[model samples]
Target: MERWPALELASTIRHDGDGGVTDDLATVQGTTRWIRAQSDLPAGHAPAGDIAADEELRTEIVALRRAVRALFARAVSPAPPSPADARRLMPADQALAHLNAVAAREPVAPQMDWPLDGAPVTRLLSAEDDPKVRFLAALARAAVEFLSGPQRTRLRACTAPRCVRYFVQSHGRQEWCKPSCGNRARAARHYRRQRTAADGGPAPGGPS
Candidate 1:
């Protein structure tokens, strides 16, 4: 399976009910822990151990997350970007280009191994240190690969209330990220219908 740690990194923020957001990566310690936890998650082949998080590193992480989020927003939205949005997207565009460049420079080759019964397997030959910047660069490359691949069309932003995350839709009927999110969305719709009825207004999607 392809690893896309940048997606997880981008999901560190959650929507608040009051038009705000909560940051899971709010602290340097939190950022360090999150990066370390990546190795434990399924499909996460990132190296184990905590990332170094000085003030400068923390700022870089924040900026990387912002760039990832902005790129995702542009990809997921149907509308074309306005002039302002176009300008705002410049940094993200540059970041993604840099990531692709880094990954391109890494050595990759196919080799036969006993583990695969003599089958040739492709591997990343670069064994670089886990500097904070390099770690984030790895994630950025994964994100770029995923977003550019065929699976990009399957990407969906979760519509669950107070949840800000991206998910790959496995089926045509799937919408929300999880069962709980679907339940909450359904209940909210029902409640809105009841309120509209009580107010003698047209029910949503019913009549004009």
Candidate 2:
């Protein structure tokens, strides 16, 4: 499955097997590592190998992530949002405004590139010298593009026990983010059924 940067940003806050949430961007070092791992970022937008994240950069990226996750929650309307940050998600309108503002921070122009033996491709050319601005702008733009695209309709929050992630449903029966989440959810359901039967209640799927 193709990983969307916006979705990845929202997934930074997820379940840590011990029933707690782990934040991938919790500190400067972690933020730097996360930025370096985003190989999918467009050319000229990703920072150089030696780039290190500062407090300011980390805060900015975390704020952008907040906005992105807020919009992701809206995208999966009626369905519950990720339990990690659902209680503190920015308002939908504010999130939209923030995303738009951040995306406009770095102005870009289309630059077509064609190698002698390859097909032509167009990429955004940014004149912004600040890597921070370019990086944040790229993330915001990705969120904007993803929210406005057809894939938004497939967005869903993982329903597995202790899971706190959003995912794009790849098929009709995909209820969880991955096979592991599916397994967890099924196990939880079975446990619930056993408990209910032990309590002298009707078995699941049987008449009450």
Candidate 3:
């Protein structure tokens, strides 16, 4: 699947498989590892090998992630936000402001490169000298772009039990982030039906 920096950031907080949430950016080392693992980020956005994350950088990145996730919650609208941070989501207005502020930290201009043997490519040229600033700004900019793009309409919070993911629906009926989540949800429903039958309640899908 195609990767989006903003989506990737939001996904840092996910199910830990033990029926609890785990934050991938919970520590400086973890944050550094996460940043390094994002090899698919656009050029100029990915940090160099020597640029390890510090406490300040980790805090900034986590803050940006909070705003992105809050905006993602808004994008999904009436649907409940991811259970991981739903109760603590930043307000939509505050999140929007924070995202814009972070995105503006690095000034960038589109530079077009045309070669005789290949198609023209456009890349951003940033005025910011600090690599850390550039990285954070790039992430914020990606979130801004994603929120304003058509794909925002397809964003949905996974409803499967123990799942806390937000995924772009590939099909009209897509309800889970992946097939594993779908299978888990189905099994959960089956278990609930069996329990209800044992309790002498109405059968699954029957009149209450």
TM-score of each: 0.76, 0.94, 0.95
Which candidate ranks first by TM-score, i.e. highest? Answer: 3
Clashes of 1: 0
User: Cα lDDT for residue 77, model 3?
Assistant: 84
Model 3 whole-model lDDT (C-alpha atoms) = 0.90
Ranking by lDDT: 3, 2, 1
lDDT of 3 by residue, 83-187 (tens): 989999999999999999999999998999999999999888888899888888888888888889988999999999999999999999999999999999999
Model 2 lDDT-worst window of ten: 42-51
Query: Which one wins by TM-score: 2 or 3?
Result: 3
Model 1 pairs in collision: none
List model 1 lDDT by residue over 1-208, tens digit each: 3445766777787665565677767888877777787773322223537565667767766776766667776666773322213345546567676556644543334343356456554444444455554566566667677778776777767776666667667787787767877998899899999999999999999987
Q: What's model 2's TM-score?
A: 0.94
Q: Once superposed on the true structure, which residue ranges of model 1 sit more than 4 Å away at CA? A: 1-3, 16-20, 40-46, 79-95, 98-117
lDDT of each: 0.65, 0.88, 0.90
By TM-score, is 1 or 2 better? 2
True-structure lDDT of candidate 2: 0.88
Better of 2 and 3 by lDDT: 3
